[model samples]
Target chain A: MAMKIGEGKFKENVNKNMEDTFMRGAVAGAQERLRTRRLDAAEELGNWEEWRSHGEEIRKHVLDNLDYYLHELAENLQKRGGHVFFAETADEATGYIREVVNANGGKKILKAKSMVTEEISLNQVLEQEGCKVIETDLGEYILQLDEHDPPSHIVAPALHKNKEQIRDVFSDKLDYKMTSKPEELALHARETLRQEFLTADIGITGCNFAIAESGSVGLVTNEGNAGLVSDLPKTQIAVMGMERIVPTFEEFEVLVGLLTRSAVGQKLTSYITALTGPREEGDADGPEEFHLVIVDNGRSKILGTEFQSVLQCIRCAACINVCPVYRHIGGHSYNSIYPGPIGAVLTPLLGGYDDFKDLPYASTLCAACTDACPVKIPLHELLHKHRQVIVEREGRAPISEKLAMKAFGLGAASNPMYAAGSKMAAAMMKPFTKNDRISSGPGPLKAWTEIREFPAPNKERFRDWFKQHEKGGGEQ
Target chain B: MKVTLFITCIVDMFQADVGKATVEVLERLGCDIKFPMGQVCCGQPAYNSGYVEESKDAMKKMITTFENAEIIVTPSGSCATMFKEYQRIFHNDPVWRPRAERLAVKTYELTEFIVHVLGVENIGAKLNGVATYHPSCHMTRLLGVKDAPMTLLQNVEGLRFEPLPNAHNCCGFGGTFSVKMGNISEQMVDEKVDSAEQTGADFLIGADGGCLMNIGGRIERRGKPIRVMHIAEVLNSR
Candidate 1:
């Protein structure tokens, strides 16, 4: 229920995830499907890079003047007869949302897929007040039925589970006997959820993007459940991260295009719903009382810092899809609701390094995430920045690593130390060297040797070889 | 064309044969090779781990060492990418940033140097074996040397190139990441080796020594019968 999901060392989590062949198969299959779909969509879109740049520019512009846009958004929403609350912390945000439900005499809230609500833990707060909460999104419904299982991915909440697992969850909770086919499961979930939506007093949804100029919230979904959640219930509440707003519809269009393509490789999502305030006098099926909660939590602190570029993220998960680390470990290993490259950088900042110190080092610095990112977040570099903070600022890096790095710093920066280190390298590794390869190595080499052979230090260093060749004029 | 070889520290001490092959291959392709002895390391190992202060000394050493060379070339893509990274590292220092840019402008990975700079696609090399190339992340993405290695290898006589499954994935040889997060690194390398085996290639060829060493070491330990060779070694072979 806390921010950390798979809380432990990254290696232990990875080992645990790797052992779960079922989960691995599910993750790898999803990644392959999503990766190809994303690539094909981008190729079809044509000038995907230009669109990405435009999206990045719009996000940067919005973030640069976030205060102005937030005010403009609040003003426009207030004009349209909607209540707006800015919560600076998670406690405040959840507290405000609970009060809204209490004032409305709400019980049995029907919720659409919303990451921000999960991030702020809003459902638990409402449930503690003794309200029945039902998740309407198909993936979310399965996870909610399975004793509120944590979402592994942003787009696919139950990404770690295959249809068989979903069927088991549905069979046990819903007591339905059916095949593990997706359509069968989806139909069963829809039948079960339809009744909940009809009786629910309130609906909660996360805003994909908020239009500041018109005070409209945009929701992009494949299932169209979000539209039902927002419109069916008499009382509706939308929760959004403060950075999720756009200045105008033009900027919103660019971002939605980039988001749909980058996230699941769709030119356009099946449903793109934009709702403004509440239903008017002439309106046909919609919520009457609407409230918008813009939660800052820890985002404001990152506004002007070096990490501001991270805010440009559209939650596309292209970075996550291509990440080598995420490919093997799946999302839970990251120990946060958010995982992969973005999570590695974002989690530690939001939750602090004490709980997620290892997240930064979880990457191989492969820059695969950096390349895959549509908005050009430089995710790998941001991850490195976390390491810098952990080491130089927080001083939380393992003492052994710090000591080793210190020695490396002294040895690497100076010519004499490097020369001496390179000279004595062959002898130092002699005990481990066999047939010119160190099959079993020592110290740092131990980890490498666990799976692969470590090449022994050459008898004659390249410096020596180069010097000899130079003196002898180039012949081997 | 005269090319100065920045034999990365790994190639300098651990994989000297790779450096030798690189020199031979470049020379065979009509390059006059110059070994810059003062070039000890590219400072990447420290720089990447956020030891900027520590890495600066090596960066300065390299800038001075290869300052006079007509064109700087290296056997490692990761290391060559490090040359491209120098400007960013010295962004605050006006004097060093320009010098770093100059180094980056002239630097290339061995295959890139041979194919792009020298305009030599075929070097008359013969290796009668099916090989799959692992395009290291730094080389293909960061350094943007994607097609040069493939272009050169396509012209190699008697060599059958197989496509590596999941070739775009990292080999889990993230320099210190191999040892720092050894458990994760082990799993990643295992998967990489598995993918290479699926290719049915006799050998795994790569541009960077770091990747080759990782994949090669795993192949050796598992006794997979798949030989791992650097691009230079593959290109130099006849």
Candidate 2:
């Protein structure tokens, strides 16, 4: 419910998540299922790489010409009698959304799954205004009922919770007895939310891709809640990050293909709903009054910068699913709603480094996120970029680390320094050596020694061995 | 073929056997091995930690060290990818960029060199045991050397290779990331070790030393009997 759910100290969060054996089992199972489904779907697509590349290209093209398309999108939406509001900050976006709700005299609001809304803390704002906001997405709804537990994943928000946890939450909150089977739980939620969907005054959803050509907004979901929310409500509001747009429907189709494949590993999700403007005559579904909220928040600053590639994210969370770090600690450890690789880069940018500085360093520079990314965001590089910014611009890097890296650069770049360092390493580690491995180490090595034995630096450096052999100083 | 061996710092010091095995394996495949005396650590340690200016010195040193070698091969996939990254690091230095590009053109991860460059899939090595391979993130994702190791491993006589669960996830050995963010790193490597053990592998194999060190160390701490071996060592096994 809060932006900083698992945002405590990273270690504490991991320890907590690790202790929850039930949650870990749930996460591991979900990951295995999703990973398999994704691969099968991609294989079915025949040219999955080409599709990924096309998706990346379209996203790049859009980010490159974002301003031009944004203006066009805004103007077109305004022409269709839809109100287009661009909020430059999170508070501004929340204030605008709240003002709209208050003006409409709306109290009960049903919401579709929208990460951007979460990023801006929109629900709390609406709550503060004495309005009830209900989440229609089953995962988010379960999280909401459990005393506003933070979403552990972007796509599968409640991935860390098992069916039993859900059953407990439902029983405690709704006072309904149900088995922990997924079918029974789904049936319970469906029965409960069906009425809220019908009676809701306003529907809020996140935009998957905003088509600039026709001034249309798109939402992709496995569950049909996003579509129902947009259709059944009298007043509809769609919140989107500015960069989540495509130049045309052709580009939209390309990205949508990539999103489904990369995120869920499917050719397409069950629903790919597109809504342009308010309902026209003869339209059986869709809201009568449409509001388009294009959120800049911190996106405009990322444009034309080294970190610009980050804006190309489609929020499919494929990168998160594949990340090894995310696999163990889960999403909440990121402390931001956008956990994982994409979250590591984007969250600190939006929320600032003070709260999210450590997020960037959470990666091992493994490049798994980059490879899995459908938009080719170069996520690992962006993480490195964050480290650079933290060190150079923010001046937040520790003095010891700075000094150590300075020494590393010097030693590694010069043969003499490297030789000297290598020569001394054996002696430097002399205190820890026993049977060629250090069971316990000092300083930085302590972390490593905590989990595994550290190999004591070898007494005979390879260069020394090689030098004697090259000069024929030793027999072959 | 003359192959220059970029013995990654870890292999040069902590795990010299991996480097030695790499050399013998390539030599057995009928390639001449050259150890450039001027070679040092790849700039990865500094670069990944955000010390660009510091890392560039080593980058420049590496460009010069293996500039003229006919083909550069390294025991570690991540370090080989570091050679490939030299061009990107030197994109602004016209002098180094072309030289870096030339180096990248010839650099290959050991198994990748054996399979893709040398055209040898089966090394005729025999290791009678069940094993699981951890696909190091840098090797598989960054260097894009996905199937070469598996291709070679499958052909090893008398060897049963189990696919590691969550094989693609990192073992949390991001150089200093292991030390800098120790807690999270431990958790990550723990999960990786668990996945490998889940495969019921007698030995856990990997192409990169950093990941091996992390996972192997944890397995030792936990007193897991699983043996950890480098892919080069496995390939060179006779």
| Count of clashing residue pairs in every prediction | 1, 3
DockQ of 2: 0.73
Q: Write the per-residue lDDT of candidate 1 for residues A1-476, one digit (tens) a residue.
A: 55677547766877888788888778878888888998898889898788778877888998999999999999999999999999999999999889989999998898888888888888889899999988888888888899988888888878888888889998899998999999999999888888887888999999999999999999999988999899899999999999999998888888888889889988899999998999999998889999999999899999999999999888989888888888888899988988999999999888888788888888988998888788889999999888777777877767787787778777776778888999998899998888988877667777778778888888888777777776776447
Model 2 error, position A190 (Å): 2.1
Model 1: residues with Cα > 4 Å off, grouped in runs = A473-475
By summed lDDT, the worst window of 10 consecutive residues in model 2 chain A runs over A467-476
lDDT per residue as tens, model 2, A1-476: 44566536766776777677776667667777777777788888888788878888888888898889999998888788888999998888888889889888889999999999998899999999999999999999999998888888899999887778789999999987869999999998998899888889999999999988888899988889998999998899999999999888888888888888878888889999998989988878789999999998889998988989998888888888777777777787788888989999988887788888888998898887887787788999999999988987888989988998888888888888888888899899988888888988777887778767898888887666766755767323
| Pairs with backbone N, CA or C atoms under 3 Å apart (clashes), candidate 2 | A7-A335, A38-A265, A452-B217
Chain A TM-score vs. truth, each candidate: 0.98, 0.96
Per residue, candidate 1 scores C-alpha lDDT tens digits across B40-75 of 778787777777676788888889888998898888
**Which segments of candidate 2 are over 4 A away from where they belong?**
A471-476, B122-124
User: Chain A of model 2, TM-score against the native?
Assistant: 0.96
